[model samples]
Target chain A: SQTIHQWPATLVQPVGSPLSLECTVEGTSNPNLYWYRQAAGRGLQLLFYSVGIGQISSEVPQNLSASRPQDRQFILSSKKLLLSDSGFYLCATSTGTGGGQTEAFFGQGTRLTVV
Target chain B: AQSVTQLDSQVPVFEEAPVELRCNYSSSVSVYLFWYVQYPNQGLQLLLKYLSGSTLVESINGFEAEFNKSQTSFHLRKPSVHISDTAEYFCAVSDDGGFKTIFGAGTRLFVKA
Candidate 1:
C-alpha cells in the first residue's frame, strides 16, 4: 500500500512568482510517479511522469516542470507562475506490474491560486 | 495514443435508485480501463479496473463497471445509490505497458435525498 503525501493543501501566489509543490511516497520503492492538474470543472491532465530518479517525461508543455530528486520524492516547479497555472495539482504513484499499472494512489492535492 | 470520454458531465439520481455513468474510449492498442472517484475537495481514488479476463469489475463500495470491448466502453453502475455515493467519477485509459494514463473529463454523480 503506497501513500502519497503532498504539502500545502492550499497555496495563494502572485503572478510571476516561483512555485514548488512537493510530493513524497511511502511504502514503496522506485515507483512510477506522476503529476496531474485538474482545472475547475475539467478532467485530470497528465503533466509529467518519472520512472526513476532524474528521469522525467513531460506529457504537456506548460509553465510547470517536474523532477524526481529521489526514488520516492517528486517535485513540481515553476519558475514564473501565470494566472492560468492556478488549478488543483495532484501527485500520484503507481507500481508497474505484469506489463500493466496497478491502482494509482493520489495525494490530497494542492489547490494553487495565482493572483 | 489513447483517449477517454465520460459522456455525462453530471448525473442526478435519487437515493436507492439505480445509476449508470457512461464512458467510452478510443485507442490504437490494447488498454487497461479504470474508474476513479473524486470526492469534493479531495483527490481521486481508484474504484475499480479491468485489465484482462472478466470484463466486469467490482469495487468494495458496491460499484461495478463492465468492460465492453466491442463497444469500447466502460460504464459504471450501482443497483442502489446512497448519499455517500456522491462524487466525481472519471474514466481512465492506459497502455498495456502502463506508461501514461489519460483521464476523462469526469462525471459528477449527485445523489439527491
Candidate 2:
C-alpha cells in the first residue's frame, strides 16, 4: 500500500515568489523519488532524487529544482523564492524493484513560509 | 562516503522509563541502517531496518535496535516507553549499492507522564 501525496499542507510564500511543490505516489509504480528539506531545527535535507521518468538528481545546490514528469510524479520547483526558502518540504518513495528502492516512504510535509 | 551520527539532541524520558537513542556511523562501503520516526508534523516513518540477518532489529512499536558492526553503533532502545513515545528520532546511512541516504542530527524523544 504505497501512498504518498504531499501538497500545500501549509505554505505562505512571498520572498521572491515562485515555487511549486507537489508529490504523488498512489500504490507505487516505478518508485524511487525523493526531495527533502527540513530546517527549523534541522535534519533532513537531500534536495532531489529520481530514478525514472525524466530522471533528476541534485544533492544541494541552492534555489531548488526537481521534476519527474509522471511515473509517480514528483515536482519541487522554484524560480526565485529564497529566505532560506523556508523549510519542512518532504516527499519520499522507495519500496521495491531495483535496489529495493532502499526502503524509504514518506509524505505529509510541506510547510514553506517565506515572507 | 556515508555518515550518520545522532548524538542525542534532546531526550526527556519518563513515562514507563528506559530509553536510549544514540547512533554513530561512517562508511567506506557496506552500509544500510535506519531508524526513522518523526511524529509531530508527520512524515518520516520506517522505525527499523538493518538489511542483513538481524544484529537485533525489531519495531512494531516496541522499538529496538542493535547493530554494532564493531561499534559503528546503531542505538535505539525502549524497554518501556509510552506517552506515544514522543518522536523525532532519525539515524540513517546507506551504501550497500547506494541510493544516497545519509542522515543523523536527530534525536528528540521526550516521553513524559
Best by lDDT: 1
Please report the TM-score between candidate 1 and the true structure.
Answer: 0.97
lDDT of each: 0.92, 0.86
lDDT of 2 by residue, B8-100 (tens): 789998999888899999887677788999998888888899988969989898999999989899899989999988988899887777576
lDDT at A115 for candidate 1? Answer: 100
DockQ of 2: 0.15
lDDT of 1: 0.92
> Which regions of candidate 2 fall more than 4 Å away from where they truly are?
A1-16, A20-33, A37-49, A56-65, A68-75, A79-86, A90-97, A102-112, B1-17, B20-33, B37-48, B55-87, B90-108, B111-113
- The alpha-carbon root-mean-square deviation between model 2 and the true structure, to one decimal in Å, is 13.8
- Docking quality class, candidate 2: incorrect
For model 1, the stretches where C-alpha displacement exceeds 4 angstroms are none
